[model samples]
Target: MTASTAFGQAAATGTAPAFDAARALALAQETFDIEAAAVLGLKARTGAAFARAVEAMLAVTGRVVVMGMGKSGHIGRKVAATLASTGTAAMFVHPAEASHGDLGMIKPADLVLAISNGGESDEITAILPVLKRLGAPLVAMTGNAQSTLARHADIVLDSGVAKEACPLNLAPTASTTAQLALGDALAVALLDARGFRTEDFARSHPGGALGRKLLTHLRDVMRAGGAVPRVGADTPFTELMREMSAKGLGASAVVDGEGRVLGIFTDGDLRRLVEKGRDLRGLTAREVMHPNPRGVIRDDVLAVEAAELMEKHRINSVLVIDDQGRLCGAVSSNDLMRAKVI
Candidate 1:
């Protein structure tokens, strides 16, 4: 049989042709090119309407209710998560579910963000009249500005892509990429408008490493009270050595009668003094101690700051101070390692 007849038979039987590595590689490269172009295309269309959408979401006293169908629905879920994590109150509602009593989730105080590439998702457009009745302002993210979804919207964000990355030009490839990027842009804008900081983001994600670094304070990781090795400034050098040995902190803080930190004595100092061939007897901590020691930190500062201070000065530990400048605790490099703040 001819090649055309064989090809027709293969199509009819759903039999695949031999795999072509070159064709696959070319298609993958084209996909990247198309999606990248789609995302960059958004920069031109994202102007006043984008700002208006942000303002509306900012002014909203209620959550931003996002709705979409099919692939758009998947993108909507991610958008909702990003918004929620970035300090905006938002949630995703499946368009199909809204017709099935989830419509009650939309309140008059809320602002609805609807997504559809064609501007005419039946599942979304079906509920538009009810959403309007509920008095929530609508924002449409769609490729077709003249579609039904856009017509019903109070604000229109044009996420229109030139074409899909699909070889058949039927799949939601570049379109979905554009939608995702647009959603991220909205979340970023809202976060900036609300003055969301890293600490706030960390609070929203306390289980993450960033939260441990930003939220953990010196007090949380420092050895306090009995755990700290300290002694009086006039204490004999032998007694200071004993304190450092017993506490196993590799160092000791010498304080005054008022519990103010006067100086610090460490193993390094002891070794240096030994190397100098000085008399090893009858030296007081006040004589051997290094006054105003390096790597001092406040208990209220973040643990990450303490890590920075230690790294900057090339010190192994720090003395933690209270508001009145009294020695409250100590933190070592080991402690920072255990806390994973580094």
Candidate 2:
């Protein structure tokens, strides 16, 4: 095209709709900034009331009953799930459902966490009287401290925000974001206060891959009984290599005549022996075995723990033993990797 024509086309494109992609991104960034600030402001509010909230949940011998309305209800469900998954016994009860006979689910020993932005949700506040009649403690997470929900609660967790990110300041976007973050803060604090163990977390999440990794034990996945690739210490390296190849564990245990593990030999050792010009066909396992290799008791060992042991010893596998030092099982790094626990 001619230069004049090309310039005219560029000018036409520049004026098209007066739109710039960066302007849309700027608006999104502004929204995120507002929400982030709203959450940050909650840090000061978490001082005393946060501790009280944790104390209340800790005092409970039963489940934590969480309730909210509208947007708050969605956030409440997430908080309850997180609390339950992290060792706190918590469940969500719809505020509307509670009015229709579900109130019976709340025991006297349970703790209640109610959520609302304006703190005047009648359905939620209506349950306060019934909750009190049942003698259950109530913790209200709300933006309005003087609102009915806050006034009726046993403890008020202020989740007040300065202003919403919505241009008209009518939407629940920023406020709801703050509330969810605050709820997470509460759940995490309760989790830490209760000293929740990884195993406990795993128990609540047994179906997920993380649970499988943390809850799986060495005994559960290791080759044991007749599956173990082992050979007597006096056995020829040729025989030991055959067993290792057959089992596909890339290693074998060197044990005494009594079948008690005494050492371990691995593929790495074979490579080194070959490099050193040793005759593998004539050598016995006793000549190439790593004496007194690290091991763990099978009755109380996790596969992740075995992986750590392998890492610390710079080895790939370990012979698991019983209290009597007899061979109970064997494990490898690959097993832990397959379980996604290492």
Top-lDDT structure, candidate number: 1
* Overall lDDT per candidate, in order of appearance: 0.91, 0.84
Error of 2 at 181 (Å): 2.5
True-structure lDDT of candidate 1: 0.91
Residue runs of model 2 more than 4 Å from their true location after superposition = 1-20, 126-135, 294-299, 340-342
**Candidate 2: tens digits of C-alpha lDDT, residues 213-255:** 7788888888788878889988987799898999888888888
Q: Against the true structure, what is each candidate's TM-score?
A: 0.87, 0.83
Candidate 1's C-alpha runs over 4 A off are: 1-28, 271-282
